[model samples]
Target: MLSKIHNGVPFKYLIASFQHQPRPTFPRTSPLPLRSRPIRTFSVQSILRLPDSKAQTGSRHKFTYDAAASFSAKHKDFNAATHVFHFNPYNRIQTQKRPKSKRPASGQDAFFISRVGESNAVAFGIADGVGGWEDSGVDPADFSHSFCDYMASAAYEHKPDAGDPTLTARSLMQRGFDDVCRDGSIHAGGSTASIAIASEDGMLEVANLGDSGFVHLRLNAVHSYSEPQTHAFNTPYQLSIVPASMLARAAVFGGAQLCDYPRDADVTQHTLKHGDILIFASDGVWDNLFNQDVLRLASRRMVSLGAWKTSDGGILVADDLKPFTQSLAEDSAQRSSTLQSVIATDIAAAAKTASKDRRSDGPFAKEVQKYYPEEDWHGGKVDDICVIVVIVSEEGKQQAIKSKL
Candidate 1:
């Protein structure tokens, strides 16, 4: 069984049998409001704090962005070419159930990328399954994977002109959580989510819950990042589907499940630049690597690939990103290997190495030390890692004019 230790205390859960129910249609209305819980704060003294930076100023031009994802399972070996996803806006949306074999190789960690209806916008994010549920005879992957799948399908079918409320990142997350709850096959499980919606006009909206998070980077500098919400050390805010039996057991046993709603998520908005980079990942990556570490890795790859250039004044974005974001040939064996994919793979590989290194003190290690000085936790935490990387590129003025003409 999967397990994690925090402050010399091993998390324990109550085991209960669950009853299966019939699946129902996806709910259009929001779930019943749940009271929010007060969370304890934990200081990240070892994390590198960076000043906020504005997006690079440039001429008014229409912009578009491309995305890719790379992941590595904690138990399996990582293969960069085989464990990558290149987002394609023109692909057909899946209406039926997705086959198990078609899922990403992220193991207990899950992610999704989907076009927003017929619009020129995209939605993507990551979800990390709470492993402690395994002790209750629940496979956490079922909940996290199904949640992402529902969100992707919802985004693909969303219509802006349908007279419905505007689809925000938090709303999308709520939709997914509601769908997962209604799914009879999920039984009982929990997960942490980080969701984002990027528009063609260069606006980004993010809704982060629990330890899974995201970071924004531009010109080799960290512009902003999301802070994790936790109930206490090693116990983060999570979306869960607890069975009635489990609830009854907890009510009698005086220990309740940590269930959080989508409304409890922290939402933030950002403006994108021509060469801005966004990285969204599960706690698996964050627990082992710092924000500055991610920025350094991405900056090195961007410069090496000529996506970022150095001039006398300052670092500049490439004139045209088509060369770097171009679609690969359909028949190519390694079609998933793109510039974004390379950067994502590099970051995942590094996190994997750090997780296995006994001498390297990662973010998790530092946090453990702060809480328990006498404990001998001295290395990175090994877990499933999922990372989605996005590259924003503004179309040239001439190209925009040509399209309009």
Candidate 2:
């Protein structure tokens, strides 16, 4: 549903005592109070070859809307995405993880929690599956699911190392990527990933692969996660991995070689105010808007916090004093992003504009375009996108990462 908050409200979550409000039937698919939309058709398909599966079986989480989100708390132990936001259709396909299989499985998206404290230390994420690749009857929905679980585990258990949470996060993601590659599915299927971690001290740490991102609303302004545009529309991210010497030989795109910089990083730290809001979304939600747009939406909410409840009474507090918290992000200057609303809006506008203009005919090509800027878009055109935006305050502190390795 095209849920909008042209005003402010309080924040709430896992509202167990709430009622289930199914999306109202609109003309579109399973419509329920969603924005008016006509069925969109794809003209081309794109293929994505991701890492192979490995044998590590256990319970994991995934999404059904080809999109998902992670938050600091748990409504229940059920494997599902926390933080109530509607699934973004730009993502398209979603999957879950399994044990000992070469790939993941297809299933409903559930929330998974690995507590760092009573409600302090936690990590959550969402991944979008590639559609064109799945057309061959080979869905990596499961692979994306496994990737999120693996990544979340690593984040929750991260060490302080360099105050560089990004480095640590990327290393873990690469390890996961490497594991899949070693198993033999490097070219089978792939997904876009985004994650957020809460520090016991009340800070934010984030990592990303592909375009999914995070947005933060502190006091009055909004902010976003790191920027990612590794390749141009004509090339692919992996294509640049070959012989540094050969690439040194061709150097075709002329763009700065995909920023060797990790797709992830350590977000700045600061005291979270009460009037704040954070949001993480797949390309579907972001491909259509920008930070100002998000701010515009936030300004509409008449309450301190407001998130349209989508899941089973998913509690999105309408009055959480987040406004008091976010109201300070800009003046704080001690942190990075302003807040989730700011970040999500900016990213979405760029991605949506870009997706509408892609010309390639790759498998899942429709999905990959969600990561670029609409006007001057040029990059590897990663197949899927994942985004995470968060609002923090004295009431909403980050869950610390418990070092595992």
Candidate 3:
């Protein structure tokens, strides 16, 4: 029997075998109607109480970020050195004449990192193509890759003065989705998205839909994270384009496709701080690793690289990160590595390892055990994994290391 495989599990199989299984619960709003709806307006301001900083003195402090990405397909081996992307704001973004072979080795999962216009801000995110689309003879990669491409272009060409509304995370997602709907090349597909925009003034905004999510880490702790939006077990809220034939079939068969709009994404705002780590990833990573696992992976990398140090009071960020964040050489290929790249690749590698482990139960396995105690599911759920890491640093702010107590 044909089934929708997401996170390496067949959705139909679980539903058929455990008809009375209690659904796993998460903190999320009820699924919205599958129709056009007004975008929910959200105030973009720092909601988290940030540590003592110059920004708290009513003066804006300029901040910079070192961003990189690492990804791998479930069927492929992960190479930490080669399968990494270092984000450079000055690099030119070419959306035309791009071949499919040039896309990241993320399989059906896609990601984009683009400088928002000429501003000092940056936008980056991930999109996970619904694996079930493959059962319908659709190439899920086409939708996800194209969706990210359109978003990158839109963000690159964005202008705050051109009578356009301010570019918020949700607006960027909506723009990308709108372009995908108009693109004649994409006939039918679906994907989940998690996007973030970090401004130079230390404010960060995020819009998340479905299982893909982002986490904010500071001082070796999980400061904040996103809640996945799902309708049922393994059925995530997804943005989709359905063909007329599929719609007609569904109407007669008395079943409907899960189609969600970008406006349905959950939005949150935060105040970024020096040495803070932000991780944006698809469900492939989240399903295999918990927040604490990610924190441990990143903390180990940061400390080993001297980007973070142990102090008497607590952990302290290094005063200078340029040595650790900047590229080693001018050549792109030969550039040795940076702190952010290592962190990104390390997390991806760990997730990949966990995904293939049969003895160690991951988050997805725990969820299955929670809802369907009868189903004998174990270990990790393997899928296409993508992770983007950002290390936030404030300019001219020196972190003082406390003396031994």
lDDT of the candidates, in the order given: 0.76, 0.35, 0.77
Which window of ten consecutive residues has the lowest lDDT sum in model 3?
37-46
Q: What lDDT does model 1 reach?
A: 0.76
Give the Å shift of residue 54 in candidate 1: 30
Between prediction 1 and prediction 2, the one with superior lDDT is 1
> Model 3: which residue pairs collide?
none
Off by over 4 Å in 2: 1-114, 117-119, 130-132, 135-137, 155-167, 178-187, 234-272, 302-389, 395-405
Instruction: Please rank every candidate by lDDT, starting with the best.
Output: 3, 1, 2
**Candidate 3, position 152, lDDT:** 91
* Model 1 ranges off by over 4 Å: 1-60, 327-336, 397-405
Best by TM-score: 3
Please, what is the TM-score per model?
0.83, 0.43, 0.84
Candidate 1 Cα deviation (angstroms), residue 382: 0.5
Q: Which rank order by TM-score, best down to worst? A: 3, 1, 2
**Candidate 3 residue lDDT tens string, 219-257:** 888898888887665667889988887777666655566
lDDT per residue as tens, model 1, 121-190 = 7899999988877766787888888899999999999886797677899999999999999887888888
Give the alpha carbon lDDT tens digit for every residue of 1-405 in model 2.
223211111111110111110111111222223121111100111111111223221312110111122221111221122222322223222222345352222221222223322223445555554332333345455455555555544444445443535433456556445554444443444555555554434455566554444456543356443343323321112211222432453354332323222343333343343345555555444434445555555544423234222335433333333332233243343132222433333443334334344442221232223332132222212223334444343322222112232
lDDT at 385, model 2? 35
